[model samples]
Target: MQPKKKIYIALKFIIPAIIFLISIGFVSKKQEEKLCKKIVITIENQQGNFFINEGDIMDKVTKNGREMVVNLPFDNVKLKDIEQRIEALKFVQSAQVYRDLQGNMLIDAVQARPIARVFNPVGKDYYISDRGEILPVSERFTARVMVLSGSFFRPYLEKNLLIDQAGKDLFNFIQFIEKDKFWSAQFAQLEVNKSGMINIYPQVTKQIIEFGSVADYSEKLSKLKIFYDKILPDRGWNRYERVNLQFKDQIICE
Candidate 1:
């Protein structure tokens, strides 16, 4: 009976001490949370859109972000607001905001990818992104993609918007050329007129290529490839001033 009584008394004191320790830990955690320290901002360069910098991102965040993030507790930080503000930047394609275990703000972002550059008829220039949206030209970097000039212009509600259907068709046609190794290196410039006639200037040969319309594009490209592989080598590339691939089953050398 004596041993059992001692054991019960020991357990009572140990349990109270344990409860006090737990309460102390909980209070420490709450106190640490209330102390909002430095405003740490991290911006990830996912797609290499070098138009904007980390300072630019933090400026956007602090200017329009929730004051709770910088002044109040870390738990009061508005993550979605930060994300939306960052994504609203002209070059930012997407952005995500979160807090780490140490209450540091982390942001992961991707920049818009430009696939083509368009020189409008009205003497304006912009980039066409892979997602088909129009992007403003960056002062930092220039992409060595396909360039379209002349009267190939499409109306848009805003400058930084997707190309219209007709413009997309033309853009896709240029994309096809860019994807092909031979044509990409050979075709330097693409020009289209108001009548929808397409002309291609090659880097290798002096002959102008009259591509006409986008109709029968695949067939026309196939024929051009055949001429490059079989006929151009034999007949000499300079023999023809112009190569017409507009017709269905004929390669007219003028």
Candidate 2:
């Protein structure tokens, strides 16, 4: 090709590239100058409760008792700060704040789901989230979940419960029960002894279930189900005061 033809071809590509960069910068500048006309907050609660609301999030997205998102330019809105403030709430699992092309500030937050309510011996009652996070009890709403108590839970107050082996077993046990429709409805409360042995209190039956350690819990629960399905039907519900499922493949009733 001739030198003049090659130069024309290069200019054709470079000129459009420069114009594209300028167009992007101009659009970004316009977006920054745009004022936020509305604020939209969305809370994801598929597995969560009404522990946090729109008003609660709005309280965090403010400066000196005044709303900071609406009526402010996009450049002035501190989206990161707003997200951090909302996520600081006890029930909030995560938060995301961003501005759209329509000059609207949007905030999306996910709330933690409580799987069990723990009534510790120290008198500090709190809820355990599905992910094993310790959440403060909300006065605004009460969740109907499995109740866990006893002296064995004291260590969780000072240290991270989810990290410990015993805590992981306990969490898994609770998940197992929660997933089972019959077991979840039958058992209401659980008490753990110093040796980590769990005692279950049934909602319909008066007999106490001696569920020894979290080890082989699935097998023990399976045996307990057999007792309920076969033995309890023939021997009456109140025939035994205690049902021991500690021994492997055995249901000791008294």
lDDT for each candidate structure: 0.75, 0.87
The TM-score values for the models, in the order shown, are 0.77, 0.84
What lDDT score goes with residue 65 in model 2?
A: 60
TM-score of 2: 0.84
Q: On a 0 to 100 scale, what is the lDDT of residue 63 in model 1?
A: 75
Tell me, by lDDT, which candidate is best: 2
Question: Per-residue alpha-carbon lDDT of model 2 for 129-172, expressed as tens digits?
Answer: 88888888888999999999888778786344698888988888
**Prediction 1 global C-alpha lDDT:** 0.75
Q: Write the per-residue lDDT of candidate 1 for residues 17-75, one digit (tens) a residue.
A: 99999999999887675554555654454355467778778777787343445545755
For residue 53, what is the lDDT in candidate 1? 74
Candidate 1 residue pairs in backbone clash: none
What TM-score would you give candidate 1 relative to the actual structure?
A: 0.77
